[model samples]
Target: MVTRDDFTEERIKKLEKNLLKVRKENRVKEIANKMHEVLSGKIISVDMNPCYLNDLSYMIKKNLELVREALKKNVSDEGSTSNVP
Candidate 1:
């Protein structure tokens, strides 16, 4: 499995921060797509190291869950407040 610093960690964090700061749903979806891309790449690379297969699966699940929760929160938050100023 890849280390935390190598890929997608920064992208995910940045998108998460931006998700908190922005009210637009489109941006959130875009960021989520970026994350999905990262995950797909990692999964495709899994054959490179059979030893790390379990580790990579666990990390992918964790990260995807985090992204899902954040997106849900953002969606609900938007629903609870004014959409336009």
Candidate 2:
């Protein structure tokens, strides 16, 4: 079960802000909804340490890149054609 203690208030607030933006604009809302529906999402798992904010920049950058890649893939039809299996 997920609890409030499991997430930071700042993180929750940021999610709320994103949701607000999603609700406010048609294009953004559509894209946000699509990203949520598709295999594109952020994974912000904070550390238990109280002073871990300084270490979050790398994680934030990684997640941002994922979001960007997802956007590019979503906007284009020229996708991967084969699996390297």
The candidate that wins on TM-score is 1
1-85: candidate 2 lDDT, tens digit per residue: 6567766776889999998887657644444443444335555345534333333444455668998999998767446554457
Clashes of 2: 0
Q: Estimate the overall C-alpha local distance difference test score of candidate 1.
A: 0.68
TM-score of each: 0.44, 0.30
lDDT of 1 at 72: 100
Indicate the residue-level lDDT of 74 in model 2: 75
Which residue runs of candidate 1 sit more than 4 Å off their true CA positions?
A: 1-49
lDDT of 1 at 62: 78
Index of the highest-lDDT prediction: 1
Candidate 2: 10-residue stretch with minimal lDDT: 48-57
Residue-pair clashes per prediction, in order, are 0, 0
lDDT of 1 by residue, 1-85 (tens): 7886856887898989898778556645554564467666733453455534444455568778998999999999999999687
